[model samples]
Structure formats: C-alpha cells, structure tokens
Target: MSYLDPAIAVIDPVAAAGPYGREGTAIGFRVICVLTQEYRTPYVTQTFDPADFSEVYQHSCIDETVAFLKSRSVVAVVPGAPPSLKIVDVLAESLGLIGNPTESLEARRNKRVMKEYWTRHEVPCAAFHESGDLESVISWADGRGYPVVLKPNASVGGVHVFVCANRQEVVDAFNVIVSRADPYHQQFSTVLAEEYLDGDEYFMDLAHTGGGEAMPVAFAKYEKIQRNGNASIYKNMFSLPLDDPIALAALPYVRSVNDALGVRYGINDTEFKMTSRGPRVVEVNNRLPGASVPLMIQRCSGLNVFQENIRIFVDGRRTSGDYHFERHYNICCLINDQPGVVQGYAGLDEVRELLSYDGERMIAPQGVHWPVTRDLDGCWGLIRLVHEDREQLSRDAEAVHAMMRLLVA
Candidate 1:
C-alpha cells in the first residue's frame, strides 16, 4: 500500500477518542475527516483533535462539501458514526463511489423506517409503533401490553431508550425523549415504541462487499443491567467464536436484514436479540461498531474491521473468509452511580493487576465532574480482558466488576 495514494474521507470519526484516527495513523493513510457543528460538544471537543487527521473539512453546505471532495484525490466516502450515515451516502453517490443506496437511507437510519422496511421485506423483527404525540404512543403501548421500549426514531448508543412497564412509565419516557435533542443535536419529532424482546442480545459486525454479499467479522453477546430506570445500559460484552451455535443460528437472519436495508457496500454493525421465536433484529447501524468493539474483535479474531473497511471500499478487495476466534476477549463497562466531582479511582490498581486485565480507558479522569451512568455517554470507562481460557476470563471479569470503583466527592 502506498501512503501517497488518494485519501479516504471519513465522516464524524469521533468515537472512542479516535479509533479511526489511530487506524489511519497506523495504516499510513491520508485521511480526511468531515465534521459538523453537532460534534462540537464538550465530550467530543475534549477528546478529539482535528490535528490528528490529515485534513479536516467542516460540513457546512452539501454542495460546497461535494465540490471540495471532488477537487481532491478522494477514493471513498464512509461514515464514522450514525450521524454521518446520510451525508456519506449522499457524498458517495455524488462521487459515484460504492456505498449503500441513497433512496434507502431512511431505512438504514430511522428505527421505525428500518422496521417497516424489514417488515416489507419479510425480515423478522420486533413489532413497533411510531408517533409524535404522547397519547398515540401510549395507546399503542397499552395495546401491546407491558414491557414496551420507547426511544427516539433516530438515535444511537441507547440514547433516550427506556423500557416502560406501565402507562406512567411510558408517559415519563415519552416526556424525557421529546424534552431533549439527541447527541447530534437533532430534535426527536417522533418516538418509536417497540415490543421488548426478552432474550440474549447479540451484535454482529459485517463487511458488505457488493451485490448483497457480506461477511461476518465478529459476533458478541451483551450483558446489560437495569440501572437508573434504564433497561439497556451495557455492563459487559464478550466475543464469540464463529463455530459457536448462537453465531451460526443468527448469521442467516443478520444477512437478510443487511439485504433488506440495501447495504451494498461498507461496514454494518447490527444488533439482534435471540428470542424464543428465533433471531430478531434489534437495530442495524450502517457503520462500524461503537466504542472499542473493533479493537476487541481484532484481539480475538485477528481481523480489524477498520482496516478491512478501507481495503474493501478503497482497494476493491473481497471480504476475507478467514475470520475465527484466536482467543477469548471481554470488555467490561465501568458504571458510576454517584454524581459529583471526581475524587479518584478506588480499586483501579487492583483491576490492572488481574491476570486477564489487558488494558483500559479512563473516560472520566481525576478532578473532572462526573454524572451517574445513564447512557453510553455517561460510562466511566472500559476495561478489556483477554485469555485463552474462557472460565478464567469470566472470573477475572467478575473480579474487576467487584473491585473497580469510581469515587466521587
């Protein structure tokens, strides 16, 4: 690979203090990062650096952005997160590059539209309702009975996601969802109410080459705990081998969902629930998995989706069939329930001393004010553990969970 080759344009590559930033630097690629005013929040401003990219372009006007990219030696346009999906689609189509269909953009981004597309395509998914009025959503949930999920139509990382067990809970969740905008600063005009699927939740990372053909890079199960009245707060997630039964059972359904959404190229991070009725899709993201999932997958499977993404989209390489488990890996999300100024980490040293403790990221460092962990943004940090022995990995994970504490003043 030549470092002087045409650059790959990445939109909103801000997650995990710059996963794509490190990937671009390590792989010797000239990357152009497109940013919008929506990503200028305190968290992003504190963690991300525009100097890390080869070139930074502010997306103010679509015509001007398209004109600028066309003037440069740009090879491909890909989304770095959920907020950039539509822009990437538009830019890729304008540049005549490989990307998902522009007409199906809403199907890939909006939760209600995604389910509606899946239903039209006969892809198995949870029953859902979408409406802007609170009473309309409540009535739909009431008809569906208790344990319904209420969330924004277009949101990521479980933002405004709530499980409502009664009318009061639905009203509260609806109010909260409509009261504020999403991380992208987009208003929530419509709320999606979905049937809560009671089963193990799993997410699959895939690379769609072309012609509705894609390859699974990794499959992992999520262990979430209900904290602060939120039912989808991620606690821990571990990688699963390709030969694992759950992986085998969910592969076909995941592929069908990819096709239904018209994902012709680029990476897809899809979440599913293995229900008693069979595998059902929870949501599909037409981008890489959020946080450090790509790094953890590389540790376990020896395949990095970030690197493969560039190869597939820029170099026109076929998807690799060599994806398999090399080791067991788990990432435990550090949860903080206390909201105050940061005092210190109580048992961080002990956690690092564990046999399976590989690495960690302290999102909320010392002296910074922290809030109670409610959504993905409120996470204290991430601790990664890897081992050849699954049992030992589990033990170390549990120990880390017990020992680690984020002290607050």
Candidate 2:
C-alpha cells in the first residue's frame, strides 16, 4: 500500500451548524467546510459564497479547494443539477476528484432530463415533466392531475417540497415556489411536475468511483409520520439489503448517469418509488448519503460509513474491506415532531442502560426548541440498536422507543 496524505474538504451550505458537520471534521479527513451560512462547531469556520464571481464558486470554492489541498484533495461534495452544481463543477475541474460533469449535472438535476436519460438507458422510471414557465408547468400539472409531486430544480433537505393532489394545489405550490427562486435567471420559476408514485419508496446508495463502475452500499426505507398532509418527521428507518435484486434498481442507472454526468468520486443517493408496474426513478444526488441514514448505516454495520467516507476522500480508496467485520442489525428512531418546550423525556435512561453498542444518541436538549417543523430538527433523539438476531433487533428498536418520551413544555 502506498503511504499517502490526502487533504480533504467537505463543503456544505446547510450542514454548517449540523451534527454531521460537527462530527465529520473530527473523524479523519483534514476537512475544511466552506459555509454559505454559519454552523455551530468548535472547529475553525471558513466563510465563502456561491453567489460571488460569475462561477467563482466553481473555480475558487470547488476547483480551488483541490488546488489548496496541495495533495490528493478529495472534497466530500454535495451534487445537484446546474444551479446546484457550484460545488460539483469545482470537483469536475479538480485534480483527483470524483463527480459528475456540468453537462451530466444538467441532465440529472432537471427531472425531465433525468427521465430522458433513464429512458435512453432502458431504466424504468415514472414519466415526468420539466417545465420552467407557469403556463407549461400548470399545463403539465393539470395533465398529471391530483396527487402529483412538484419540486424546484435547486433545493435540498426536502425544502418546500409538496405532494399535491389537485390542479389548485399544484398551481398554488408553483406560485409559492416562484417567489423563492431568482427571477433574473434564464428560466424564471420553472419546476418539475411528475406523476405521483404509490407504494413503498426506497433510498439507494448508488455511486460509481475509480475504475469507472457503480457500487451499491446501503438502503433505507422511511415510515413518514405525517400530520394534516405534512411530513412532521421520519420515523422508524429500516436498513435494507443490497444483495436483493430489486434493491439494485438504481445500480443499472449508475453507469449511464456517471457516463452522462462524468461523476468521478463521492456518493450518489438515488430515490425510487416502487409501484404496481415496477420501480421508477425519482431523483439522484451527487454527494454522500445525507446525515442521519449514513450514521444509521454505521450503527448497524459497524462499518463507520462516516469514517470510511472520510478515508475515501483522503485516501482515494473505495471499498471498506480493509476493516471488515460481520454485519448486524441497526435502526434509527426519530423523536416525535410536535411543538413544545424542553420539559423531560421518558425511557431514555432505560435504553441507555440496555445499550450493547455505541452509535446511539439523544441530540435534543431538555429545554431547547422542540421540532415544530420536519426540516428544522433532524432527530429529537436517536435509538441506534444493533443486534445479531433480526427478531431481537426488531424488538430492541421497539423497546428503546418505548423507553423514550419527551415532556414538551
């Protein structure tokens, strides 16, 4: 093995004050997170902007990141379409980075382009519309009619995402989204309108790295606890198996997407909903698996995906086979999303008392703000219970949650 010292930086606009940001820097990679906004951390913060210098963010932030590393710089970058590719472009221009090219970023970010790409690859996916104008968007929505999904081209963490059921709802949502986008852009307030998917939705960890091949790492299914048509929280995340043929749904698209997007390194999380016909592609992200789930994968597999992720960024190694261990069961139980003050919690102590492994935590403070919204708070408290027996693993999750109750003041 070649001894190496790879300097890495993970640039995230949303995760500055996030737990992932806090924990990520400590693990391994020499991470320098450029914040679009301030984030909570004891680590030194470097401030930067995507709005500066006609794509200066592209060269300075992303391209310059690799340059500054002065080594094999691997940025744990987040991927998106054209508007969101500020970081992706930097990686694309860099010296030993893995990511999609600007052209592929366009095809992947815009839902319509994504559908076309999938179709070209013979990959099964729901039909979608990529329109930028209010008229075209409304027409597309009217055609899909009731129970359709509408989202913006450049956004993350499920920001302002809605599941509309009628023309009124979609039109209203389009109007609302229009207000959020930059009106001066070439296309003003354009959005993707797609057919609503029924049945279970699975998040696949799909990405292609060195040697130019796709690798499927982790899978997670969410039980969305919604209130009044709003997703208040994501509860009971179940880790899935990659070996299953059906679970490999996104693997087929990896090659096409990578070849199209020119993705070199980092992670790609693709979400596809299972329908009566089959699995249809939803969207693909060109970055690491978001915060909570990656931690959940670590808890169950004892693989420390976060740690392994850091290693890849700093070392250019793909597989975590070096530190292999027997995999076990793992689950992340989110605290209920209801507004209240920090009073007290129940069963937390009991679960802690029964802990057999570590990756477990309760991030919420006793008197801090309780989650009134889904995106604001990640997990009120997480129950990462790992066990060998699937039955015992299931029971442990139940018992741990049974042990937890928040006394919202």
Candidate 3:
C-alpha cells in the first residue's frame, strides 16, 4: 500500500511485527508505528525492523505523538503490546477511532482494578488485595490462608509472579517484586496478592468486532510445572477443539469477562483456571496473545487473528461463524532449569526429525549467558509442533522436552 493510503496506528509494536507490520501490509493498509523505549524487549530491539512500518514516530510525548497521528489518515489505533494498552485507548479516543473505552482503561490493564470490575459485575474471579506495605499484603494473605499469589499490579509475561506457600514465602516474593522494575521499566509501588486457585490453567482467545459481544476464537490448556517456588512456568500449550467440554463450559464466563473489561474492539487473551468451584479468571489481556500464539492458531485452525483484526477495524467487517481445528497443534517451551552461560543446544536434530515438528524460535543463542527459566520471558526458546494425529502431536511434544536440552555452563 502507498503511504498516502489510510493507516492504522500501532503503539509499541513489540511482538506484533508479523501481525500489524507485515500482515497489515498484506491486507492493504499502511502501518504507522508509534515506537516507545518504555516497552523494550528482545523482540522489539533485536528483531523488529523500522522498514516494516510506513511511518515511525517516537513516543516521547503523548501530545506530540497524538498530534502527529491526527495529521495522518489514521483510521484506527491499536496496542501492539501490554505496555501500550492505556496509551492505545488514549490515542483511539483522541483520534475518534474504533477502540476500547478510555474510561475503563484501568479495568483492562491493572490486575487489581480488573478483579474489582469483575466482582462488581458479578463475574467469578479470584479474591485479592493490593498494597505497597508488606504488612498489609501479609495480613490479607494470612486471612485467606496459605498459598496466595503475588505479582505486580500491571506486568506481563509472568514477571516476578510467585505462589507463596507461607508468610515467609510471601515476604520473599513481595521483596522481589518491589525490588526491581517491571518488564516495561516501571517500578512497582504496590503488589497485588490474591488467593491461589487450585486447578488447571487454560488460555482463551477472544475478539470483539463491535457492539457489546466478544466472540471466542480459540482455546488452549497450559501445562505449567512449578519449579523454584514459581507456580506458572509454562511447559506446553496445546490447542483444544471448539467443541471440547472445557471450552464449552468456559466460553460464557470468558465472554462475560470480555464485556466486564469493556473490551469492545481488538483481540482479548484471558487466562482462566478451571477450579473446583468452576472456571475462574486468572487475568485478562486486551491485546493479541503473546509467544506467537496467533501464528500457531492460524497454522492449525486457519484463523489469522491479525488479519481478522485488521479486517474488523479497517474494512469494518464483523466476525461470524465458529473456529475449528484442521490439525493438532502444541507449543513446547524450551527451558533452562539452571542459570549459566549457554554452550549450545543438544539433540535439536532429533527434535527436527520428528514428524510433528513444525518450527522453532531459539531466543537464547549459544554463548549467551542466560538466567534460569522461571517464567515465560526466561524461556530459552519455543518449539511448535503440528500433525494430523493428536497422538503423534502429543508424543512429539513430549519428545521435544526430553530431546532438546539447553546446554548452559
């Protein structure tokens, strides 16, 4: 598309280079990238190219940026990452474009505010408290009993999230979260503590084309193994059929969550725990699912979230029909259990030889010193598996974990 064509403003296009950058071009719209150093990541700094964008503007001042975006023929404003969630709302409201309500920005981005909104709307959510004082957090957790969860009020990729089994653990977890800045480089003044729900965690991807309704697009159950006191170290995530029993049960609750958060436009990625009580929400993100999840969904189900989102915003198309899987898909996270300098990856050839092996993203290259894989961000890389047979896909996914080893010295 020509630069003169109508454009979409994508703020902090971190992991969305493929989606809003390249795929947006394929769908016939110029992409205007509003860059930010505040949300820097390896994906943004090392992988993204400025050439992919039609016009790049540094977001040092919001007024200047909004003024510039207003000068262009921008039709819609969308967030490319979590840090840009609030900013996207601001821009969209300022530009008079289709987007989420700026009035409920906190309900979409802050964990504490989100839960409060859900509770007010009578949506089932975990019990929680937010405070900067350790005594206040510990007191709340004590009343709730042992094994509470502690995390930043507005952080992504499971940064500093810990499942504390006792008061000591809570203290330790609290110190860690408050001691460092979040992935977005913002210091945490308050930590959110919530009662830990005991059950399997599942990821549900939804889209709100327009109106008050949000459609369910895809669902995946996360296989998380607790290690080193962290409760949500992702092992693998496999796609579930639309008609799956769990998917059926969780659909209504997730849709309610979408509505509660005021996510009337763009994609929503919500994580829910299938607790003994029922399906309870873990967290809600008003952006595309991270870790190339949309790509995997497209590969297996032929539903390109990126393309569909552009179609909805740019072409004014409403989504219809249900999503179905054409192939079994699994995303296996490559982990380094111990921290050290990387030597090389072992048994990768064997992993590639598997019938279900589709592709891999090796984030930690050889000779790079890396920390132990405690959360999604610390993972060595990710290996994607796809096959016609679900059994073969499962076997290959397990084999990937066993065969592929991150050799850290």
Candidate 4:
C-alpha cells in the first residue's frame, strides 16, 4: 500500500504531540503533524464529569485524532497514542498503519507481569515482594539486607519510589503508601521492596527491531547527586567503555524480556545498576529517553533515534542488529537541591558559546518549574558536547557543568 505522496496519518491532538514528535522518526515517508480538537485538548475534556464511568473515564478522542490526521493529508497513518492503545489499535486496524494487533501490547506496560515473565525466563532483577499489609515490607527488605528500594508500580519519572535504609524508614514508606488517595494507581506501587544494589547507574535506550527483538542503541552512565531524600542534581556522560560490560551482562535479560512481553514498537529507557556481581536490571520504560537522548545521539554518533525509529516504522523492517556508535557528551544539570518554581536559568549565553566550541544541542527554558528527585530525575534540560574524542567528552562535561546553574524561586 504505497501512497502517491509520502505522508503519515498522525494523531494531532496537543496532548499527544510530544509523542508524535518522537514517533515521527517512524515517518521516514513524510509526516503531517496533526492536532485533534478532541484528542488535542483531552486534558480539558477529561475534567468534565461524564455520566458513563468512574470519576475518571477514559475519553476516546480518536475521532478527533482521525479528523486531525486527515486534515494533515498524511500519506497514511502513524499514531502515538500509547495511553489509548485501544484507539490506536482500532485506527491502525481500520487504516492498516499498525503492524501487529493490539493484543501484542497488553503486557508491555505492566511491571508485575513483566517480572513474572522475567522470573520464568530466569532473567535477573532486583528482588521484590507483593503484599497488602505494610508491615511485611520491612521484613521483605531486611531479609535482603540494607539500602532497599521501594517503587510505586506503573509509574515513570521516579514518582513515589523511595530508598529506605532501616526498618523505621520502611515503616514510614509503608505509611505513605497506605495514605495514598489513589491506591489503585499504586498497584505497582504495591511496595516493591528490593535489595538496593549501589553502583554505577547506567541508562540504556532500546528500540524494537521490527521483527520482535529488543535492540540496544545508546547508553549512558549517570552520576546522581542526592539532596533531601531524593536525587536533586546530577550529571550524565555517554557510555562507551561502560557500555561494553553492561551490554554483555544485560543483553540476554533485555532480549528475553522483549520475547516474553511481545513488544514490537516504540522506544524504551531501561535503568540498570552495576553490581559487584555484574549489571543488574532495575526498571524498563516504554517511552523514549525524556531528556536530550534523541539530540545527543545525533551529536555524538551521527545517529538519530528518531530517524531510525521513523525508518523502522515506515519500512516495517529490522533495525536492531549491531552497529558502531561514536561517543558524544551530554550532562543534565538538574535543579535537584531546591524545591520551588524555577524563576530563571543561567549559563545559556556561556553554554551557547561552549556549544559553539563543541557542537552539541542546548535544550532548556527559563521561568518554568523544575523539581528535584533523589535519583536520576527532573532535568531542567541539558548541554550537549560532541567530539570524536571520548576524553574531550569527559573534560567538556566537567567544565560545562561547573559553569551552569539553575535558579529556582
């Protein structure tokens, strides 16, 4: 089914735009960016108390998504409705945009199910427990020993994930869980008390190689700076040397999980810890790396995850074999130490000058709220410096981070 012109059917709603931009990589065939009146402003429509369902009902903005896509005059369709798999599934089925049936994605979003699948496959990860009674959480972690991590399930962006050192801290974490107004949302938050493996934290971005394979693309080891019980400020560098050992240790686990889950599309961020034994899997995300990963890859390796992703989607072919990735430098100077609305930013002029020297992407805006976290979380944006020289990558990373500051009011 070839179109006379290269166009893609896209969900143009405002809410789904960011994903559409990321998903656009799949539209190597020309993309018509779209916005649905319904899907575009769903966050607003979602507020109206509808009669059919719970206090919160999923409002299907597909028709609006369709109208918007049609307006763009795309060659065909490329949807980014991860949240509404149902809508995208139907649209894909009717229009022949999606590769697999919707059933393929069911297991992709759930962590508990993924854990079970991994366990059956003998894949390695943090030891975890599931219980309603909060008191048992301490025993779960204590049994594993100190420095345990408790994560609220079904969450991204490190929300409600707590690292506890002792029994009392575990109790406090449990109390916080029991007190959540949205306990159901916390189902994954069901207190995954696990042995916290402390070591180098490596961030890996994986794309599905069209024919059902998890392909490793880019990886970085992030140094976390913690303040006030969460990762507040931080730095990240491209993982080249670090990529080797972890790639060897973690690839089998990544491949097996993809096989077990039957995921075929989209990008993912899988965070792992370098344990004394080897690299250990912590959590996997179904979306693209949130920060400057897309831009960073372009600056360093001359590879664009977006372009590669788009090529795969448009062609519906294999993408994840093996490839050589040149190294580049990227570091996020997060406003993690202070908790307040961001008033302004510093070092843009100097950073721009720095980028002029090194050739990296500078992505950040002032007068926005930037919150802090305990781990690698909440980026104000990042500074990219790219050179063939890995040593230069490190040297520039240190020099630039020292120069920038985030002012939170």
The whole-model lDDT of each prediction reads 0.82, 0.54, 0.83, 0.55
| TM, every model | 0.95, 0.73, 0.96, 0.73
Best candidate, TM-score: 3
- Which parts of model 3 are misplaced by more than 4 Å? 16-18, 38-40, 43-46
When 3 and 4 are scored with TM-score, the better candidate is: 3
**lDDT score, candidate 2, position 46:** 22
lDDT-sorted candidate list, best first: 3, 1, 4, 2
Per-residue accuracy of model 1 over 212-267 as CA lDDT, tens digit each: 45778888889888855587777888878876899888888899998998888877
The all-Cα superposition gives candidate 4 an RMSD in Å to the true structure of: 6.9
User: Against the true structure, what is every candidate's RMSD?
Assistant: 1.9, 6.4, 1.6, 6.9
Which scores higher on lDDT, 2 or 4?
4
Between candidates 1 and 4, the one scoring higher on lDDT is 1
lDDT score, candidate 1:
0.82
Worst 10 residues of 3 by lDDT: 38-47
Q: What is the per-residue lDDT of model 4 for residues 72-130, given as tens digits with 9 covering 90 to 100?
A: 44434444333433354455555556444556454455566657666776777667776
Clashing pairs in 1: none
